[model samples]
Target: MSEQLMVVGEITAPHGVKGWVRVRPETDLDQLAGIKRCRLFWPDNKERLFEVEQVRPHRQIWLLKLKDVSSRDEAEALRGALWMIRRDEAPPLPEGHYYVPDLVGLEVVTVQGESVGEVSEVLFGPANDVFVVRRSGLPDTLIPAVREVVKEIALNQGKIIIDPLPGLLD
Candidate 1:
């Protein structure tokens, strides 16, 4: 099967005197515990495969040691590099749960059958996610990622029907 790379974390900064790096995980802390290997992709499109040498929790960050990186300087050089892994490497999700990418490109329609827009992006928020919708004649709208407003989401059909609350379009 073709490799499906999914970004799992970002190199936030270099760690101590050693080459260990501080990573900001994109997945939940619990989900991160199972990551044993990852592929690093540089901003220039170069890719380096890495095996997780060590992983430990450090407050809000994850201290990581890659198989090849052994010094602080080497880790620092990787700062800002996105850490990716094959999609199949990830564990299965529970029912009714969907990844952010699955929401992209889904058609957004009102309960009345009017086309309001399409899902342009999914924004992460402190409390909940927000769906950014781009309409043809109106400015982009932010819809709270709630089941009430997002009446129904059909990933297979690539569509989402919403019963937007009052003034949601304004």
Candidate 2:
């Protein structure tokens, strides 16, 4: 199998009889624009690398066309397959901004240097991304993505330091 890459989107369904497909992008629209090619993988581990032929925003979803796919049957066959691009292929973001997948598995600590937990997930809510910390022998805690609470995020070192407000972790 090819090395697993970051999933940028998924083939939700065939859009038309001429082979257009509706893609539900997991990445931001700006980030998606930077992906000129993608590696698609099916559930059975089958994979194909395709150059992006066209991409356009359609309502909330993205309409995509692959260089080789030319029929509704071809597109339908790819439904549910994850469309991934190399992590390095993603466009660079400004400082302090991070992709959700990049934040997972980082060690979380308090400003006092006490180990709080490890980041298990990054949840997208109406407000902002919530960092889900899984602590040992305790319930998971949700840390809001705010500058006041999150003092530092060291992605290179796989660490995060937070100064959680009182009762925030209770």
Top TM-score model: 2
lDDT of 2 at 41: 87
Residue by residue across 1-98, what tens digits does model 1's lDDT show? 67777777799899997789998866544555566788888889988889988878787678889988988889998999998888777666677666
Query: Residue 111 CA error for candidate 2 (Å)?
Result: 1.7
Q: What are the per-model numbers of colliding residue pairs?
A: 2, 0
Candidate 1: clashing pairs of residues: 18-72, 19-71
Best by lDDT: 2
Q: Where's the lowest-lDDT run of ten residues in candidate 1?
A: 25-34
Q: Looking at candidate 2, what is the lDDT of residue 134?
A: 97
